[model samples]
Target: MKASEVMADLRRRFPNEPEYLQAVEEVVTSIEDVYNEYPSFEAENLIERLCIPDRIFSFRVSWVDDKGKVHNNMGYRIQHNNAIGPYKGGIRFHASVNQSILKFLAFEQTFKNSLTTLPMGGGKGGSDFSPRGKSDMEIMRFCQAFIAELWRQIGPDTDVPAGDIGVGGREVGYMFGYYKKMAREFTGTFTGKGLDFGGSLIRPEATGYGNCYFLLNMLATRGIDIKGKKVAVSGSGNVATYTTRKLTELGAKVVSMSDSGGSIIKPEGFSEEQLDYIFELKNYYRGRISEVAEKYPDVQYLPGERPWKHVKCDIAMPSATQNELDGDDAQALLDNGVIAVSEGANMPSTPEAIKKFLAAKILYAPGKAANAGGVAVSGLEMAQNSQKLSWSAEEVDDKLKSIMKNIHEQCEKYGKEEGSDFINYVKGANVAGFMKVARAMMAQGVL
Candidate 1:
């Protein structure tokens, strides 16, 4: 049950898939000690089985551009596991999409869904298609083509797909329309659909709000109040804006928000009015973070830099890309007296950064436990669709909060060390999530 021995085999087997290997290593290492305690698990080779996905569907997506130019992109769906429930995860449309990234995302999704206490398995799908700079028509055509191949492998009780990265409401709408047309059945096969359809209320704000709720729970454990706490949040997408919105509502100051180009820094923290402006900028106009600087003369935009370097706050939320915050950024946040870190994005903090946080004994909430809110709401959407009903915004929000609180509790149960008050959330999340999935796999037997 040595972590090194298992990691060596995974590295050998997945030579080119660094992201997937990293994800597997993190979980295996975290649960190795507990895994050893279960001799039956070792005999059944549960870890080895878990490392391999149940199935992977790969196909080519062909679409014509506005100018009638034909384009082809690789699309994939990694259906990792389904012992607990149906396959569930998001579809990321970005230039960085690949087998490695999607595999890592699907692997992480297995645990993230488990943390929600929802009956969802793990799956992820996407393409190397970049939606940025593409016109509305071009994006639609691309999405329709992408779903043409994906429609067959997914269904309401099969693999339920949501949106991620460049795949937003528009993209999801396009894909869902295509799926509905192709399948000739209108169902809750997709989670992030428009509200006019089967989408759940507050689904867009679920992840962000959930992160804060988990953060609040973490703070409560330490008897530290969130009021008057200055926070630094990165990314200008729905996750970032909504996280800022929730933090602001909870009496915390969110001083920074960032994008690929740079970060927008406001020493006095952004207001609800400003967040509205940002929402319109990113969501409606699809503009850059620099545009906020032009609209508001107070905030400064650091070109080609992450907000972590300039952080001066009590909390940090990296809602951007994977490994965006590294060891240096962790040091910067620590130097600025950051007491907690809530990750909104999958693997936002690098292993090095996570090590620093663990060493400093900060209240660090991994995305698996912290960002389960979105999927929790997605799960609610599934239930609503099944029951032919729709819950109110308040109902969905209450459910999401309860799910986040439960995830935090699970982390606390597994994360706390013997005779030590410090909570290792990463270890907690991995062990807790693995136990459920592993038990299910063992009972289901060598599938």
Candidate 2:
């Protein structure tokens, strides 16, 4: 299939869904040549089928606050594809959640799951419900209400939904509890459940830890040691916090972390104590990142700013939301002699920023391959649940490391330049993942 023609048709059909369309265009552009080689794939219109989700579930979620006021929010679940295995992805709860965003996320999850070498398909569900400034009881009520509309559509083996953004362990617990009550059977229908109820060890830190592992692989190719490298990681969530922890353990200095409000820069590098404080600030107290500045005299908070442009570092990890890093941010990193960028968030870098990274031939790893550790571990959790047993933290951590290494190797194998040392990880990840899913679809005969 022609990339331009496919993207043009998609644009016409999905006129206002820029995020979903952008995801489609990126994958199709990278895999077009390989896709054209399979005549059966073209005859079956596999590319088109892959671009669209299998089904989308939209419902209204209603919940009551502590004040006895009722609220309504839009909830969605995009089951992108189940060609290889069951649908598996996260459920986000943020004011910004929408069809376009979840569609893009689900589409990206397809390839990300494929790269993990796990038996899973792509799916994403979320609501436009903001968890910020909400009481614990309110959040729990909303989670139950959200799941009430979706429990029937999901199962342990059908579609396993995990946590993302505003939905964490607490949200997952509430939803899973409600789902268990409604279904009247306890199953691993949802991942990221609390450890008390079948959650895997290191599940929260998997994505960040995995990104660091992938970066090590990338850096190792050039015989560069991670010991003395300075890293600027954005976002103060699980991914960002754990990324800092792992980097510090490896002797790298992480200079910054950020949230929606702004960034906190600790140029001397954050201590383990400082990282823990930031983590508790966000995860527990739900305080603004700016509070870090008030607590520590050495830390500087930049209001309404991201850490990329202001920090001079050897590596940059965009652990924040989608499109938070742009071409200008990329150029600034490049100008400051950044050697590598490993995404810990899905699609954190914009198209232009990716192009700049590719043109520069730096060790840039995309989210699909780099940030897949979370889902990889989720797949592990599924396995553990099926076995009715839990693996030790060391065992799970080993598996996570092995998976990240394999993902990095896959990128190297498919993304290696014909004659140059530069590797195009984006093309590699897309092509490799597409090939796997395409072959699976072909074998299944146009379902």
Candidate 3:
């Protein structure tokens, strides 16, 4: 369980996959006790098997833009593992897409999917094509072209992709349409679709709602309550919006919300009407957070800084992109008397930020565990599609809430350390996920 031992083993086993090695090292170092408890995990060569992905497919996507100019983008599908079931993850579309990030995400997905207790493995796919500022027709053409090459590699029973930061319901619809057209079959090959077609209710809100549910469990452990507590959240995307919605519903005063460009803080708390207007600006009009301050004279917009830097609150949720919060942000929260942080995005906090939170004994939930709700609901969507049934909004929301509670319990059960009030969620999540997949792999006996 020592850092040296973990690094040595990782380096020895995964010499070529630096991304996979870094992820494994981080999770393994946190849960070194698990390896100590089960020494055979290392002896039986499980680490070697688990460190490498089962398959990685790379292809070229050539599509035409609105200007009749063709562009080529690289796409990848990293099937991390399928010991439990078929691969499941989301497809991201952004200019920053790269093999290392995708592999890390896929590696994280393996454990995230396992934490849901669903029969899903781990996988991820995406292209470096940025959808921002593209016309609807241009985006559709890119999606169709991307899926034309992707369709041969994915299916309902094989690898099902959902939405991520850049890929939303629109991208899902476009991809699904292309898949259906090329394959000439109606199948639940993808999730996060329009509910009238094959999507499940509450899919859009699952990640945000589940994040609050997880934080609630963490608070319950210490007899804390979110009611009347001040909360600061980053990002105005689906996760942040729904997180704000649920937090406000639970009697928490959400004082701040931000997007990529800037952040806005309202001391009087954002009203439902104000939130509705902000939602319209961001979701409907694709506008920036700076516009919120102009529309609502009461709100204050802080330019070029994250909301976490200036807000004082009881709870802070980093719902923005990866590594959005760093050591300085963590220190600011700690200085402001923040108690808990639940990640709504993948690796939103840098390693230094997480270390600071852990050192301060604050409740910190890692993204892989906290943000698994999206994939969990996506898995449910796949189930409904396979069964040809759609669950009601309440039903789906209830299921999502239950799943979040279960995930929290699992983390608490495995992540608890003696003399530490702060739970080791990273360890809990990684080991719980690894145990499920390892047992499945053992049962199958080396495929």
Q: For residues 317-363, write the lDDT of model 1, one tens digit per residue.
A: 99988889999999999998999999999999989999999999999
User: Order of all candidates by lDDT, from best down to worst?
Assistant: 2, 1, 3
Candidate 3 collision pairs: none
Q: In order, how many clashes per candidate?
A: 0, 0, 0
With a 3 Å backbone cut-off (N, CA, C), the pairs that clash in candidate 1 are none
lDDT of 3 by residue, 1-447 (tens): 465775797687657765556677777676566666766666676666776788998899998987789999998899999888889999999998888778888988999999999999999989999998999998999999889888988888888988887889999999999999998988998999998789999999999999999999989989998999989989998899889889989999889998877899986688888888877787778789999899888999998889887879898998988788999989999999999999999878888898898888788899888988899899899889989998898999889989999999899888888886667787788878878887888777756
- Residue-wise C-alpha lDDT for candidate 2, range 1-447, written one tens digit per residue: 899999999999889898888888899999888888889998999989999999999999999999999999999999999988899999999999999999999999999999999999999999999999898899999998998899999998899999999988889999999999999999999999899999999999899999999999999999999998889999998888888889989999989999999998877788778888988888778899999899888899999999988979999999989999999999999999999999999999999999999999899999999999999999999999999999999999999999999998888899898988889999999998998999899888867
Candidate 3, which segments miss by more than 4 Å at Cα? 1-22, 419-422
lDDT of each: 0.92, 0.93, 0.87
Candidate RMSDs in Å, in order, are 0.9, 0.8, 2.0
| Candidate 2 stretches greater than 4 Å from native | none
* Model with the higher TM-score, candidate 1 or 3: 1
